[model samples]
Target: MDFLELVKKRRSVRAYQNKSIPDRELSKILEAARLAPSGFNAQAYKIIVIKDEKSREKLGELAKQPYISKAPIILAAVNTKLDDKYSPLDIAIALDHIMLAAAELGIGTVFVGAYHNEEIRDFVGAPNTAEMVALMPLGYPADKEIAKKRKEISELISQEKF
Candidate 1:
């Protein structure tokens, strides 16, 4: 699909099939994140790929969404540099790239942030200086096309000056 179509097709998939993602596809997704532009090229972030069921269960317990544990894979995006002023922005862009790449590869992903930070930090073995940005559960979607609700252009766009 084209870029626009890919964007439109992307959805926050919460339900997934009981299957594993191939290493090739996962590598491609991570490559997208690695290639994403960062402020000053400081790519101050790291991704912890979670595949162990026990760890996924621990993470799911810390998160509001228990369904996350059902996914075959989970990616924990982390900002590796606490001193980097634009770490959050950098991670956001990287995560966006990952999601878009996954969409193009016919994989499903969802951004999950509501979780116990301390527990996640320990589970991922992140340093005390780093920050846990978000968790993304990935796999093949189990259901049909997901419907989306979007605001009209008029409500979102603005003129040169407010």
Candidate 2:
């Protein structure tokens, strides 16, 4: 699918099937993130794809987000080796790539931003220099749901002199 279509179809999948995502498809998703552009091409995002049920359970607790433990794979976005000034932006971009890629692969992904940073950082075995940025659960959707509404363009867009 095209980028726009992918974006439109992409949803924060909350439910998932019990099947495992293939290695090649997982690579494709990660490749999308790997190819994503970063500030000055620093490419500072680090992703730890979580497949272990035990780890996912631990991560779910840390994130305190129900979806984290439900999906077959949880892609934890992290950036510790890089400086903090732009870390959030960089990780977010990478996660976006992963989300779109997952859509293309007929997989569902949920981008989760709420969680306990320190607890998740430890659960993922993230290095001291790296910090947990976000949690993305990936799998096939168990059912469909309505998309959340967005603000109107007029309300969100600012004028030149705003």
- Candidate of highest TM-score: 1
Each model's RMSD to truth, in Å?
Answer: 1.4, 1.7
| C-alpha-based local distance difference test score of model 2 | 0.83
Of candidate 2, the 10-residue stretch with the lowest lDDT total is 79-88
Q: What local distance difference test score does each model get? A: 0.88, 0.83
**Regions of model 1 farther than 4 Å from truth:** 114-116
Error of 2 at 109 (Å): 0.9
lDDT of 2 by residue, 57-95 (tens): 887887777666989999888876555577678888888
Query: How big is the RMSD of model 2?
Result: 1.7
